[model samples]
Target: MSTTTGLWLFRRLWKPAEGTPVKAVVVFLHGYGEYIDRYDAAASVFARSGIVFWGFDFEGHGRSDGERGFVTEAGFDAFTDDAEQALRLAARQFPGLPIFVMGHSLGGLVAVRLGARLAKAAEAVDAEAGAPLFGRIKGFLLSAPAIEVDPAVAQPHLVFIARVLGSCMPRIRLGGIPAGDLSNNATVNDHYSRDSMNNTRPFAARFASGVLAATEAVPGIAADFTWPLLGMQDEGDKTTVPGACERFVHTCGSPDAAFKLLRGRKHELFMADGYEDLITGTIMPWIEERCETAEPEAGGAAAAEAGLARDGMSGDRDDEAEPTDVDAVKTTTSEEPVLGAAV
Candidate 1:
């Protein structure tokens, strides 16, 4: 409904139903080279659920007015600070609705760290309150959280350089890998390209540093986060290490965390084929469950059915260790199939 800009900020808003009980606020963090506008459909899904949806284009992404695809170590700290400011603004606008955060791709990493930081901050603000803004977070929905690295894919030397020389060279190109390198589902790429229109590939210093910081901080964040959490992982994602996303859910501070596998989905599960059901059925129900007054048990049977790791893999699978679906993509030479194009 409104746009706002400030020091290192880009935000957009959508109002909830008039006089409707503001169930909760959903703040979406878009991933690398992504803009908030891409979430229009997702936001509508939340609106139908009686939640207000707000999000921003991260620095260097979309129309944020920064060097495209660049981020440095210090820049990440600044980015989080800016994100907090946006949250504060949300508080002012929505008065008392519960708040939740969701992230996709690289954004998931940001949400994890933010949840931790918010938890600590909330602790300090109202130590006696049952659920301060921190614990009050209804839940976090992280789609294809980018954690760990796939051994099969060739590592990008430039990405490595940015991590090392982030301070010196904060601005660089971080895109332009191949389809197989990024995702096993070509349809995902097709949708991404069609929806985004501009396929600029640039990397920034802060992006690398932000990633480094997120990697080290996410586990601690997960360990400390007591709020409910839902993590959805695509079995065929190539950009993000797969098992790592699911592992994040199981290891979170909350024993009641839920993890779901979007059958045959890829990195951007929401963008994959048959994703409508994902948003309307699985995801919406998870969020709705959180809005309820009672904190029900999470994913009792779903987690087990989704194939939880019972061994010492610790979320990392062997390079050659491909499950049937993953291996199908890895071994087959045919053009990668898109899951949700017809939808």
Candidate 2:
């Protein structure tokens, strides 16, 4: 886990018991040409609930180091400083517990910019208990959060000429995201084409302008997300943009934000096919009710059983106008969303 661009960053863990007393502490983030050991059975289902998973491998994905599926321009703006250096190394390797951040696709836009810079660095101070746990962060689940870019497959004129002509030859190459568009679940597209540290190719026009400036800065920081949020997507997710992650979890400013739905059109729902019902009925009851923050409503009852949009339920492919997701073997980037793979 060194860097200064000399690379190295590869860490991965999944301890469930070593001297028990675990109910929280996760920082998983795999997505966009994956790695972190393919979430080894979703970090053994949060180490069978004792929970203490981990992550890394984004300096150039998989076994870290750099080049495969590319990155640069500050290695794609240090994906939220390597997930806030794995959330301060999971609060110094799980000291006072209470941390949950389960990002998928583009690590759910860098865990919503490290949960809005640890919710404004836990509101300027008084993080209590020897201070600076950055307000202990007890939530954020998101799975398909590449926040906006499914214009029926990358069509804002191919995301405006792939970040305006790939920022003038910024490492060129281009094309990606078609391991069967990541999941119509043919055995998770044949185990993402027999793994091999899955990069699946073509990317690096400055990693497509760092995935279009880290997913176009997630809906302008969804009102500066105060933390505690749930996301889950795939209303025919052709990579990202499940109604731009249901309008950025209903424009989060978190009163415990929420939005759920991961129907058949999968985007690696931890290997699809009942994926243990998103882990024994929705992510261990939202990590055992946030192990301390007295959890209850990330829009409760599994987001009213995924009917979302509060209730007015809008579907018809969530049209607030459309046209994105692409790559005919090479069309710049944007989750390599091919036009036909409906999810």
Candidate 3:
């Protein structure tokens, strides 16, 4: 059973299905323009693991009070605050339970920053009271985080131009434009349109400002983060460039940061076929190990120890706990359509 509670004008929950215990909350963050409902299937998986799931609608997103597809400059910051409030409220509802934060795409970036902020805030409280401020989270899960701007195309100039132009014309409604303004393509997939969870309109001035703020802030989060972090990036990801994902894996400051490129998978790894099984069978087990057994290694411990280490990271062992050959996924050809399918 799951019960919903209101926090910051949004709904959150403690979902305990599939025999999950009363404790063990997993806070989920949906991607841009998307709502928590898209994660219903994922929540069920957590329930089966005896883990309660919690998630909410960002202000400009589902079920929250705000203009549809319109975001303000304080967008990301507000979302982060809402998430933190949800965590505190959840703690009150179910005390003494271990919590994990997981985010997808834009949400992934949010989780990384939020986790580090929580730690820092707690430190601030400890300095004054000589006691930890909040229950430390168990771990972090980032699936295809939208950390780096995609490099497949000439992005910097495009982004800069958009920012500059948007400043002059802040109220532009890009949703009706072909290829949705960002790509300028004609056949931008309909899934984005039908999935009301996503924000179909153009980025509001405030929201755009928040994105720049987030991008600038990512380095600080990466440098300060001290929790176990797992990143699952796709080799064939179309939304975020492979180059960016690779850089993020090494740049994230967590000693335990590890990203595996699912060979055949697309940007949305969670929604991909068979991924639920892979997560239940592989990733979750590793997260459990960190939560129950040891502190996550920082500065390239997990990757170096896993023997799959690459890109300037080096370690002597490959003790990553995985059934041999289970991590392999299929690869895609250059000719395949990148945006049409979900997976």
Q: State every prediction's TM-score relative to the real structure.
A: 0.73, 0.32, 0.72
Better of 2 and 3 by lDDT: 2
- Sort all candidates by lDDT, best to worst: 2, 1, 3
In candidate 2, how many Å is residue 59 off? 21
Clashes of each: 17, 8, 14
Better of 1 and 3 by TM-score: 1
lDDT string, candidate 1, 31-119, tens digits: 76667766555565566556677777776665555566664344676556656666666666655566778888777777777777776
Q: Which scores higher on TM-score, 2 or 3?
A: 3
**RMSD in Å for all candidates:** 12.7, 18.9, 13.1
> Model 3, range 1-343, lDDT digits (tens) per residue?
1112222355544355433334356778877776766555556566556566777677767666676655554456766776676666655655556667888877887887787787677666655452222544766777777776544333677567556655776555532212232211122234446555466676665455456668667876776676666667766667654545445556655555555556554565555555556567656675566556423221111111111122221111111232222122212234432112223
Q: Which residue pairs show backbone clashes in model 2?
A: 151-323, 151-324, 152-324, 153-324, 153-325, 154-324, 154-325, 155-324
Where does candidate 1 stray beyond 4 Å? Answer: 1-8, 16-21, 128-132, 151-160, 172-188, 194-199, 294-343
lDDT of 1 at 106: 76
What is the model-wide C-alpha lDDT for candidate 3? 0.56
**Against the true structure, candidate 2 has what lDDT?**
0.65
Index of the highest-TM-score prediction? 1
